[model samples]
Target: MDLMAMIENAMTSPVIYLAILALATLDAFLPFLPSESVVIAAAVFAVSGIPSLPLIIVLAALGAFVGDHIGYLIGRLLRERRPGGRLIRAADRIAPHLHRRGGALIIAGRFVPGGRTAIVTASGATGYPLTRFTFFTAIAAVTWAGYSGLIGYLGGVAFESNSSLGLVVGLGLALSITALGELVRYVSRRRAAATGAG
Candidate 1:
């Protein structure tokens, strides 16, 4: 079937919660999955009373945190073995800025595609102190989960009110995600340039 029908079917499925948790985990590490869609679907399912809002939030947060930690460990291991690895080298350039403005970066990164993964990798590659990384990452995880969940919940409400509402809200969210990604890229490039110039 088409995308909307598939989503509607998934929303009613008994295994949707499991699928959502899995999606959240994969999305965190893979960086390419449409994770936002998964979370929104979970919220939509919540409207049907299959998955509770609190449960969705908890599962989403746990899955995201675990996935990020895994990514971080991978980055650390890779950097330890190959200090000059391309990814590590790029991460190294931003390590200092990450160190200085980690909290803000982590929070903002949550909204940008590929940013959460990049931040986790940079944290490990840069050897950021574990305690600090954990503290900030926890904050970011909570913020990200809550924000995404809220969007999904809102989407569900809109879908319930009117079919056109879903389309409008989904399109708006998509645009917001794209704009945020572009903004993050611009900021990163500017920071890199300034660091070079200085």
Candidate 2:
């Protein structure tokens, strides 16, 4: 069967929620998992009044939050293993800014493919504060889950006759959002560098 058919079949299973959770969790450490796509599919199904939207959001958010912590723990463990090094020093240089504007990074990363794992892993490796990281990541998790779901819901609703088109629109919008966020970050960094030089 095709992608939509497969998704529909998967939804029939009672443990689909568990699958979503597991995929989201693994996606935190392993960027290969298509958690975002699964989430969008689930949201699309929800729009068709098949599955519940809130459940998808909750599962996605919780999975994201816990996975981030797992990355943090991995970093903390690595920190314990090594002392001061060039890598640590470099991370330290960026730590303060990460702590200051970390929320934006976390939120933006959620939408970017392969970004969630990288951001959280880097944050942990650099020993960013657990409390602050948790606070910001939580917000990012909720926002990402909601925003992703909403995007899929809108697409599915708008293109009910052609799900393929809906999926394309949803994925396109997500990528566009990621691109815009990266652009903003790039501009902000350039402005900061210029100010520092001045």
Candidate 3:
């Protein structure tokens, strides 16, 4: 059997769900985790009936929620130990904005590499309440996972007959979507800054 077929065979129920979940959780603590890619891959596999879309979403969301909490806890611990540190300073600066727009920011941050980890961590460092953080993060994680999974599913459908085309298009679209989000965030921040300066 070819590599993909072999992989699909090995992608038993536990392997598929557990692997995605682990990666998703790890990415929360380490922004460089590439959990999004894995989720996309899982979605791609789901296209062939190798896995289930709902299962992928479930595992991804679970990992994201749990991982973010760990990151928050770590930030809280560090905050207690590090007086006037960078995290604390950043938290102070963003705390007001986060307080006013925590849910929106969390949702947007999920698409921005490194942004979610930093923001979530900072929130904890600044004593952002666990209850509020969980509420916002839970929502963000679900939305982010669903969006990513859909992207992969669509890409897989497009490449159903052409693997290379599907991969190229899938990756391209994913990157494009992320870029768009970043652009919007950049412009919004700039506009807000400009208004503040006025």
Candidate 4:
């Protein structure tokens, strides 16, 4: 079945929420799954009163956190094995920038497609302290869940009210997230350059 149809089916069942959470967590490590659609669909269901919004948000965040931590652990393991493992070596070019604007990079990474995995992996490879990593990771997960959920909820609201408005809003939210990712990258690069020069 197509994505929308799959989402619709899942939404109709009680297992949809759990599945979404699991998928999102796995997506963090795998980096190829469609976690965004799952979250969006859950939000749509929540807005339609099929599930509670708070629960949706909480579960989504939990899943994201779990996935991120798993990725981090993998990185840590690699680091422990070799100071300059494959993961660290690949991320080295951006490590300096990531370290400088760590918080912003983490947050922006959550919004960027395929970024969640990269951030978590990079965080691990960089040897960011566990405490600091968890703190910033939570922030990123919450922001991602909130932004995606809100957009999906708004889409549901528009579906109930006006289709045109819902379409516009959904598109706008997607575009804004993409733009924010670009901005974050730009800022990080500039910061890294300055730090290197100094």
Candidate 5:
């Protein structure tokens, strides 16, 4: 079988759920992996009722939650090792802001491509409260999973006649959303900087 055929077969198989869980979990620290793409693809296939949509959302959220903690732990470990490390220094500089608006940053960063890892890791490095981090990260994971899955589900519904086209639409929508988010963040930062200068 060709690559696409093999992937389709796996998506239809019972193991697809496990695959989703694994990919989402790994993608937290390893942003290079295409966990979002996997989730989107599975969601696209879910329109046919092979893999359950609810299960996809739940597993994806759970995986993300677990993976986010791993990033936090890594940051904590790094902080313990190197008091003079650049990451620790950066975390120190942002510690006050993190305490004030950490939850918002944690939640928003989850949706950003690599922002999730950096923010969560910095949170840990800065010794942000565990309870607060857990609470916000939970929200982030669930919302992120829901948003991604829903986008794919919508694309699938729109292009039910063509699954391939549905996948393309889903991916395109995901990319567009990510890009929009980055644009907003950029604009917000620039405005904040300008205001600070003035």
Candidate 6:
């Protein structure tokens, strides 16, 4: 069988849920793993009813929640033991803004690939309130999971005859959204810099 067909068979197994959870968790800290794509693929298969869509969203959210907590703890440790660490230093520099808009930033960053890791780690390093962090992170995780899964589901519906094409469409949508977010952020930063200079 071809590679994709083999992968599709493997993903259809019962253990795919656990795989989804694991990948989502690792992607939070690792940032390089294609957890979003995996979720999208599973969701594309979900249209076929092999894996439940709601379960995929729930597991992905739970995994992201747990992984972010780990990142927070790691950042806290660095702040305590390595005050001069690069991440800690960076966190220190942005601590003021993080303190002011931590909730919105956390939620928005969760959608970006590496931005989530950086923001969560910085939040910890800066000792941002745990209560608020937990609340915002929960929101971020659930929203992210739902958004990713639904996008895939929609793609699958649009291309019901071709699951692979559905996966591509879902990924394209995700990348487009991320790019849009980056553009917005860039423009905001430029405006803020101009205001500061004025």
Among all candidates shown, the one with the greatest lDDT: 6
List, residue by residue over 1-198, the lDDT tens digit for candidate 3. 897666556453568788889989988778887788878877876787768988999889989999889888888988899968887887888989888888788777878889888878877887888898899899988998898788878888988886446656766789998899888988999999999999
TM-score of candidate 4 versus the correct structure, residues matched by position:
0.79
For each candidate, the alpha-carbon lDDT, in order, equals: 0.76, 0.78, 0.82, 0.77, 0.89, 0.90
Q: TM-score for each prediction?
A: 0.83, 0.84, 0.89, 0.79, 0.95, 0.96
lDDT of 4 by residue, 48-118 (tens): 67766677788888888889999989877777787766667887777897788887778777877778778
For each candidate, C-alpha RMSD in Å?
A: 3.2, 2.6, 2.3, 3.8, 1.3, 1.1
Which residue runs of candidate 1 sit more than 4 Å off their true CA positions? 1-3, 161-168, 177-181, 184-198
Please, what are the lDDT tens digits per residue for candidate 1 over residues 33-55? Answer: 86667666667556657667777
Q: Which candidate wins on TM-score?
A: 6
Candidate 6 Cα errors over 4 Å, as ranges: none
TM-score, structure 6 vs. true: 0.96
Prediction 6 global C-alpha lDDT: 0.90
C-alpha lDDT of residue 61 in model 5: 95
Candidate 5 local lDDT, residue 116: 85
Model 2 misplaced regions, further than 4 Å: 84-90, 190-198
Candidate 4: which pairs clash? none
Residue-wise C-alpha lDDT for candidate 2, range 164-189, written one tens digit per residue: 78877877777787789889878999
The window of 10 residues in a row where model 1 has the poorest summed lDDT is: 162-171
